[model samples]
Target: MHKNVYTADNAAMLLIDHQVGTIGWTKSHDVEEIKKNAILLAKIATAVGMPLVLTSSMEDNAQGPLLLELDETAPEAFAARIKRAGIVNAMDDENFNSAVKATGRKKVVVAGITTEVCVVFPVLQLLDEGYEVQVVTDASASFTKIGDDAALRRIEQAGAVITSTSQIVSELAVDWTMPKGQALGKLLNLGA
Candidate 1:
């Protein structure tokens, strides 16, 4: 497989800061839509048996905790979620970084609550560390359109693939008759 390409076998997922308090700060995309797309990523990871890591920042204060639906969708990942003390950049948190490294997959699919900071910071760091990163656009949002658009441009310029939830679903599904494909089709109402 090409280094730029990501498949279920070669990819892992890293969801950052999808917390209740932080989600409301998002104005780039619909809050519910972001939640749904993020959940879809979790479901995709679960269906394909891909490794998934979830991280949150300052849950007890303002950030709140990761979405409960994410926990319910991919319980195993939720069980091992990294609860960061106050790290804005998840990759800076040793536990979060270690968890991502433990997946042993260099191709990472990432999504987060805020596009400008929460999503962009670790993505840049991951790219610097030679990881192939794909940022799910709709699954991550920001406080304003300008910030979100700027962040998307910045990451794309830095070599991370700027992609969408539907694109990832399509890339991973491949065949509608397969289990992962069928699961994704039903979830997205693709009529498989």
Candidate 2:
């Protein structure tokens, strides 16, 4: 495995706070685009058998609820998702932090709604804990482009890898003939 790349074997996915209320306010990317990218990442995790952990915050209120499509896309992960009770930083929530730790994978592919807080907070903690963090920018968004860019810069400067859904797919699926590669290719309509 390449030292800098997170292949399927070395990585797990943490999809955070992609809730209806949060996504409805994101301005960094089109809502549909964010949904598409996030859903694809979830599918990739499932296809490659990568451990996945989903998280949400205060689903009963303004946070609304996690995207239902995510549950449909990766049902097993959805079943085990961490429903945080207003924890701004998911890592600060014991259950959420424990869930990620339980994956037993050192590299984490992360995406979330409202990049500045929901994504950046746990990401920083994950980095400090020695995990290789990959932030899928397109799949994560903020209330403004400036906020999103600032969050990306902060994580990048602190040793996290700033990435996109497509880059992640390519790295995890390094060979088109491999089962993971083939599954990802089919998802991307690349004629597996």
Candidate 3:
């Protein structure tokens, strides 16, 4: 497999700051729909045996905790929760950065709430560090449509591929005859 391509072996999934408080403020997409997408991504990643990282900004305070469905569906994948003290970006937190590095996969499929801040910050930094990053747009949102649009444009301009949840799952699965592909189809309700 090419190093730059996103395969099950080369890709990891990172979810950042998808908390109740933050999710409630998202105006770019329906919060319920985003939740479903996020959960589907988690399930698909877990089913495909992908390395995963889950993080929250200020779970102890106003930002609230990660959605329960993520934890329920992919408990093991929810391996790390970097509770940032004051860092606006999860990449700025040492533990989060270290967890990502430890995965050893250079292609990261990432999404987060409030696209401009939570998602973009670490993506740009990861791109600079030479990771092939793909941002799952539907799995993330912002306080407004404009903010979400601008953030996605900024991420694209910075050279990250903007993708959707199903696209990521298909890319990772490769073929329907494979076990991972079969599992993904079932998980997505596409019928095996």
Q: Which candidate gets the maximum TM-score versus the true structure? A: 2
* Model 2 vs. true fold: TM: 0.98
Q: Give the range where candidate 2 is weakest over 10 consecutive residues by summed lDDT.
A: 1-10
Per-residue lDDT of candidate 3, residues 1-192 (tens digit): 555568878889999888888999899999999999999988877888888899888787878888988889888766556677758888989999999999998889999998999999999999999998999999999999999999999989999999998888788777877788889889777786
TM-score, structure 3 vs. true: 0.96
Task: State TM-scores per candidate.
Answer: 0.96, 0.98, 0.96
lDDT ranking from best to worst?
Answer: 2, 1, 3
Q: Please, what are the lDDT tens digits per residue for candidate 2 over residues 1-192?
A: 658878878899999999999999998899999999999999999999999999999999998988999989999888888999888999999999899999999999999998998999999999999999999998999999999999999999999999889899999999989887999999999998
Q: Indicate the TM-score of model 1.
A: 0.96
Question: How far does residue 97 in candidate 3 sit from its true spot (Å)?
Answer: 0.3
Candidate 1 local lDDT, 27-105, one digit each (tens): 9889999999999999989888889999988999888888999889998899889999988889999999999999999
Which has the better TM-score: candidate 1, or candidate 3? 1
Q: Could you tell me the lDDT of residue 21 within candidate 2?
A: 93
- List the candidate 2 regions with Cα displacement exceeding 4 Å: none
Residue 18, model 1, lDDT: 92
